[model samples]
Target: MATLTPCFLRIFAVLQLAACSFPEEPGPLISAPAEVVRRYPVFVGRAHRSYTRQEPLYIQTVLKVNRTLYIGARDDLYRVELDHVSGDEMFYSKKRTWESNKNDIRICRMKGKHEECRNYIKVLLSHDGGLFVCGTNAFNPLCANYTRDTLELVGEPISGMARCPYDPKHANVALFAEGSLFTGTVTDFLAIDAVIYRSLGESPALRTIKHDSKWFREPYFVSAVEWGPHIYFFFREMAMEFNYLEKVMVSRVARVCKGDLGGSQRVLERQWTSFLKARLNCSIPGDSHFYFNLLQSTSPIIRMQGRDVILGVFSTPSNSIPGSAVCAFDMQQLARVFEGRFKEQKSPESIWTPVPDEQVPKPRPGGCAVQGSRFSSSNSLPDEVLNFIKTHPLMDEAVPLLGHRPWIVKTMVRYQLNTMVVDTEAGPHRNRTVVFLGSTRGTVLKFLITPSPENPYSNTNTFLEELEGYNPERCGDDSVQARQPLSLTLDKPSHTLLLAFHSCVVRVPVARCQLHSRCMKNCIASRDPYCGWTKGSTCSLLRPGTRLPFVQDVEYGNTSHLGDCDGEFVNLFGM
Candidate 1:
């Protein structure tokens, strides 16, 4: 046993932070497109509420189910059909969903003082042939079910204490998995106590330790998704490991097994037994690593290269670094980090250290119980193991990014990249991952990530032209999208990019391949997964539709690497 001095500890942390993930020389920064494309027009659609109100419209959540967009606003829920837009599909102030949209279902109708009781709809999850809706009912949270067919409230309203946030503005996550509802949100009225709670399930209800800063310290949950047997939650919280002058926010990925029954009623009564979290690293590896520590949003787990991948959108939400990044992670990588050693701090004054492997008990502490074992379930596990897990849930090593560097990094930009969505399409060689980033300025940026030509293990990212101030066909220049927080979800079934703003939900095509058809280099440089340069002299999807062959150079902007695009592109450039 050795005790580390304060000076030595500081040096250890500094070196560990720098030499953490990169075991060898890191790859070069990914290259941008040779020519920058700007302001690709987007087909924007604004949902029209049935009627106008006095207060400013504060749109909260836009969930797409089947072909309907279930939009949750401050006081109403408007259901807009995607393919059946009748009236003007523009962002007009007067044309509400009454004439253009399909259904205008009001989910929030609260009666209270406008303090914290304003019925701001927050959580909207489809469950059990209906909609499990919850709202911030003037500080008291309530949840109810609406019939899926008619979209009418059917069930009685019940308490949503741990299922939804008390403040409508707080960042929260609601996930419905295995016929259960799970949430990461604050429970109290003042919005101080944050929790990861599971309710309305066949299994016993479980939650994080209450008032325990070790579990959640001022956490702002980004999103949650079910991967394999575990529910992964991405969030940014105050780091409990470091005690600096100013509190440092660290990105985290927390995991909880879906089948976890609460621990023994004696030691850990209704608390989760399979709960663990690890720091997520989205940094540029070099002499000095620059970190995007605030995780804003995460894309759904999409399969790529025979592995499940999650693309996270991280930014300096604290406004310290005016930059943002998009990082991809393999789900298996995070599973390994959780299975690694556990970290613990002896006291407030002691340094956070990893517990020796020999000290860990049998069957593992934070793992789902086996069907046949000495301790069949967490409730039957030994008190010693439960106590050990109760204190130490954080992993020692941070989860490294998929590659050593971020796929896309934008520093000193005017707008923070708050949200992103990922679309994977078949490329000439393999599957190409396209990334779409939404900014605070109500714009969407597109890019693609492909394997590097020099090193297959490495990756190269290409940025498409920004979707600058171009108006949609129907919408005028004076649209209603304000400079508010944005959220992005890619509807793969419909091939639509669903961008949610404060005022409306805008739907646009995933890729504008035709915009780059004029120039062969530009089409290849676009790097959009849904697009390709065809031999018939046009840009289109990679298919045999009267086109001889498709020319794609997603790897690098150069057509030579594609092996067959040598002379075909020369004629396009008048060479």
Candidate 2:
């Protein structure tokens, strides 16, 4: 399980004790709100009249639940509720906070030629106790299920073509699993085929192969997570194994096998017998690396250091200065590069090899078989393993990056980091790690990791603050929600941080240290692992396993704990 040649020299090189390194140009020490003194107060997700009446509500999907908040917007659908915890906004609380009366049977937009009907609610899943919603209804993609405390509509209306994405600004990913829903989007209306599908399953509907440009070359999906019997997803295509006259793109991470059931109506019929796809290396390491290659946003499969990790949000379009990065990947290095080797590419004029472990084929083509197990599913494999997975679905190593670089890395800072979340509070000793990026001009940084004192298995970022979330001169003329981008939502049971902006959704504070540090050296220079400094009581929030006398260095801020605040908390700092 641990052998890939020093994990590829622990993934590329540049040692001080190598295994990962990068910071050739890192910036952001602290920013805005007068150097992060943070008073903490934002909370706006509903002014309703659709973002304060008469057109301007662009929030395309949010889903908090528990102090509720559903919100999906464009042709509307909402349900906000937050009756307490100071960050108020209980617009009709006991009345259940509703707005979704949607029954939507538009049946693919009933023959309208003036095609601009506008629905765009774009998939917002919740699972189990109901609330699955999906929409682009004007372009005719349906899907329903609501009522998490009366948002209504609970049965009938399902056929959201490749599971939503008829172009409400295409970017998809759905997920439900075992109760089947799994999507990756783009089934057509001239959106150009691209799919990963799987639709309402338990047996019939599997996708990915129709119009296959060698398995999706125009992708853009970004974000999907299930891990285990596999689900993965995360995208940014167009590098069918590189051919460049300038096209390249590549930032993938595919997988599929929530018990795949395809092949056997002539090799991959309803397709995707365990999809495949690799390449997500995110460069910056070494004798010329640099890469970043466009993967805009991913993070939901967290739990670092103890493993699992996800965190992406790369960028690379440089025509003269444009770059971004945050990288993290490592689900056992993507299951050891999807269990190693399988890239072939034989005829578009030969040359991208790797298929020979004596012509490799057995119980592996992205496995997940355990029903009676004996090659238990892709409809009973072995036609030479479905013809070696229809000419190999690409994968010959290239998953790298656990610490080959990128915890954060901008470049001349021209904005465009669209969305990421990763949180784990309560630590002066254990659970602490945080990172919340999101920028496309409205800003909201907040890093604070620490482990690499030169590879303690790598990691070391600390930007700490740049929180000016969504401004454009304070929405004058509603500034079209500032070109609609910036979508984070980590409501970890109310440690709060909703932040949307395309129709507005703001609730901050995943730590301004109990709403503005009352001292202990400004709560240890705001290294904020959710704040500390307690010994005589002041800068708060240290909860999990607190034996009292707090102080916090969280991973390595170590300001010598300010020599224990020298005497009666030096007046415990003030008011």
Candidate 3:
């Protein structure tokens, strides 16, 4: 690598300073004129909560089981019935389940003083006909189980180090699979040790190497899920494969086997045998590599063909560029990279190189013992495989995005996209994928994913709706209330979306786009698939009683049927 000159270094520093200048617009800059654009009003329903002097009102997590919607706040849990609300209902009510005890409020000081020692429920997973709950108990986390019917605590507190975050704002993930809990988080109170641990119901826990350089490096955990026989953890961290002088961040997927157990010897005593990470590339197709380095959020969607694809929301860091992008990674594409060569750095100043197959340890490091072996337990496996996994966990090649391009790209903006949820609905001709993207401005935007007419391999997304999760006027003096989206979950049974903000949770009905449009021209111009012009001179959902004459996809902004439109639309122009 070449050394940077003083002149070039000065210019680079100036460019970094300009990246912090925030834009005035809260979201992607829309070029549509205000006159022709129709802003639809969102119908929002609130969940009730009993506020106390010490308890915070903000909702941290949202989960739906059966027909009841379960919401977790800092100190209380509530369940709201979905059947009471009619099919076309817009609002509903709530009922409380349980509140936190004084012991849950116990606190311990770590980085800052006056950090409130309160139980903020961060992890909520469903298991065995009940809910598994965890909270940040003032840096000392705790976990418990509750019955789904009564919504009451059923057992004593359990360890929650990897299940919950010490701070409410820290990134963490928890998943349940095969009657076990898998989590990735910082275990220590000072937030130092970032570990991936698997806890069986009554068996000893299995974790990654503690504070190991090759394992993790201050990772910001995004999402975790269970594939065929492997559990994958997605996160972003400083690139350890690069030279020290080049400080770049990369998104990665680390995989561990469901049957993995700790090694027997001193090399990796309670550590993972099937642990490896590879880069996730989300970039444009060009010579000048423009990378979206931040993996802010992710969602796993199972397509109609029974194939799974992970949708990730990525953005350039504040020091690089001001932009956000969405990319989808197919499981078939990711599986090939994991089977490729491994990335290794010989020296501190040297670049990463792929290790030859001959140099790789026998039993093919990171492979499960069941593969070409008879051992089912970690104690029975050979030590050579465990030793290789301790150091060579990073892969040589990077996993490319699904279509060689992002599905949605927004640049020169301010709002950072936080979370995403996807659902499939029946279109006029075929099934269409609808995406719900949450932002930091307490706004949830919806779009319909379709194929481009010009390029079959490429895809297009049509903006459908915009919803504000909270009331900006309620903030009064505090501006934080107007922003901050905590979580977003789609309820298919109720045909509603549950959005969690810093202060509360709101339910917004989907597929109501036609009811908000006043004119046929404006409805079609909005490019929303849910909104269509009907023969009754009004915008509405398609039904058996409706007669259709002018119906187009309207996704490509095609107005060729404008000449066929009759009614007040033609008379207003004096045609």
Best by TM-score: 3
Give candidate 1's TM-score. Answer: 0.81
- Cα distance off (Å), candidate 1, residue 110: 15
* Candidate order, TM-score descending: 3, 1, 2
Q: Which candidate is the best by lDDT?
A: 1
Summarize candidate 1's per-residue lDDT along 1-575 as a digit string, tens digits.
99999988876775575455334422222222312222322223343535334455467787777876676776566666665653434232211121111111122223333444466778888888777888876666778887655667775788989988877779899989998888999988667889899989898889999888888899999999998889999999999999688889999999998988988977778899888999999987866687889898888888876778888988865535467888888899989999999999988899999999999987789998877877778899888889888898899999988867787877656778888877675343335667778887767777767777776545776665466322333232334346444678776655667776665456666666766666666677665556676666778755323244566655555655333433444544332
Predictions: Cα RMSD each? 7.6, 19.3, 5.6
What ranges in model 2 sit over 4 Å off?
1-71, 77-120, 123-160, 163-206, 209-253, 256-266, 269-274, 277-328, 339-433, 436-448, 452-455, 458-504, 509-518, 529-575
TM-score of each: 0.81, 0.35, 0.84
TM-score of 3: 0.84
* lDDT for residue 475 in candidate 1, whole number 0-100: 32
Q: What is the lDDT for 311 in model 1? A: 82
Query: Considering summed lDDT, which 10 consecutive residues are worst modelled in model 3?
Result: 34-43
- True-vs-predicted CA distance for residue 278, candidate 1, Å: 1.1
Ranking by lDDT: 1, 2, 3
Model 3 lDDT tens row, 1-575: 99999988976765554343322323321223322222322212333223323434656777877787677766666666766653322223543334344544433543353344666778888888888988877667888988776677887888778778877767788999887789998888777899898896453578898887778988989889889888889999988887667677889999988877678776677678889999999876654557888998888755634556888999887776677788988887787788899988788678889998988876677866674456767656677777777889999989988878888776665677877888766334336677888877766777778867776545877666666654444322136544677767777655567666666555665556444345666556655554566655666654322345444355565655564444446332222
In candidate 3, which residue ranges exceed 4 Å CA deviation? 1-55, 83-113, 202-204, 244-247, 304-306, 371-378, 426-430, 453-457, 465-467, 474-482, 511-518, 542-550, 555-557, 563-575
C-alpha lDDT values of all predictions: 0.72, 0.70, 0.70
